[model samples]
Target: MKDLFDEIDTHQPERQPIGEGAVLLRGYALQLGKDLLPSLHDIGAAAPFRHMVTPGGFEMSVAMTNCGQAGWITDRAGYRYDSHDPVSGKLWPPMPDAFLDLATGAAREAGYPEFSPDACLINRYEPGARLSLHQDKNERDFANPIVSVSLGLPATFQFGGLKRTDPVRKFALRHGDVVVWGGPSRLCYHGVPTLKHGSHPQLGSVRFNLTFRKAL
Candidate 1:
């Protein structure tokens, strides 16, 4: 992949507050972008991305895979986290050091210094792929914040209130952007809208999101 950091201007990291306990760290992950992709590629090779089916039997638009101690999955049974990948029948690949560092650093910067994630959900979105608004309540603990890193193409992120029908605010997330939400906003409904058709010089037409959470 080409070095996108070189093409973009070097600037101080900017923090944009999204809610009472949520923030958007603009260009916060650029420092680690070059190393992240290679580690992600290795993890994907071990446990390939697959579109999972929801409990309602509908297939998801985004392809997903995971690293660390647990991997999230959904099916007729329901949504839950498992130590083993259902398809491979083996433990999910270990989370890379760089991934852990990025997650912890971002969380700390967002005011959650004790965040230690056990699961990192990797979501791949192609043109037109989207994620529906949902809460991250499947995890056992709600105290840990969610650290989501955006890579490749840009996307529109929808952040809503506690209830599903609550008002929502949209934010434009570009490559190397990270969002952290915890405390009272940990269970807030959030998702990505349909990805626009565009080619990112480094990552082609796909957008990859790495969401770190404490699943256990």
Candidate 2:
């Protein structure tokens, strides 16, 4: 926690890919099917996705919800892992098979074949939305890798180091692109840059990101 997280409540990090692990697959998974679009609506039905507040009290630009054994939530209680949706007081939506299949496949393709993520953070970013740079240190275990799938309007992905002082590497992530980072790079600070204004025929003016992780 340095000057980095100070304005973390309001800083737009740069965009770049840190290493070879960051791959832009460009439409590699577009063949997943059109029904997948409505699948999100179903997922939201159970979780009732919302814009979560950061520990700093600022609202996140990205509307996030989850579907799995655990969901990521933040309130006055601070950012921590929870098993139930605060909105419905019920367990989060079940992770879809398509999502699980795609996640595990991407991990194996990235060389982490044994990945079994129990938490999936679904982010929806409309035009002008952005995520601040922060490490995924809240998870209970660091042994598992982070699997992120990007879809819709392209956004810059900033990957940094263990310390706030460390400079960042950025990459432009587009539809169907998946990035997996773990091992020596598992505890890195990463986030999305300011989303550009654009419209995707499938997702409209919004960008959907699936960040699959093993919370426990």
Which candidate wins on TM-score?
Answer: 1
- For 104-145, candidate 1 gives per-residue lDDT tens digits of 999999999999999999999999999999999999989889
Model 1 quality (TM-score): 0.97
Model 2 per-residue lDDT tens digits across residues 45-116: 767769888777888888999989999888877988888899899898888888888788777767688999
**lDDT, model 2:** 0.77
* lDDT of all predictions: 0.93, 0.77
Regions of model 1 farther than 4 Å from truth? 7-9
Model 2, residue 204: C-alpha shift (Å): 1.0
Clashing pairs in 2: 15-170, 16-169, 16-170, 16-171, 17-170, 17-171
Q: After superposition, how far is residue 151 of candidate 1 from its true place, in Å?
A: 0.2
**Candidate 2 residue runs with Cα over 4 Å from true position:** 1-26, 31-35
Worst 10 residues of 1 by lDDT: 1-10
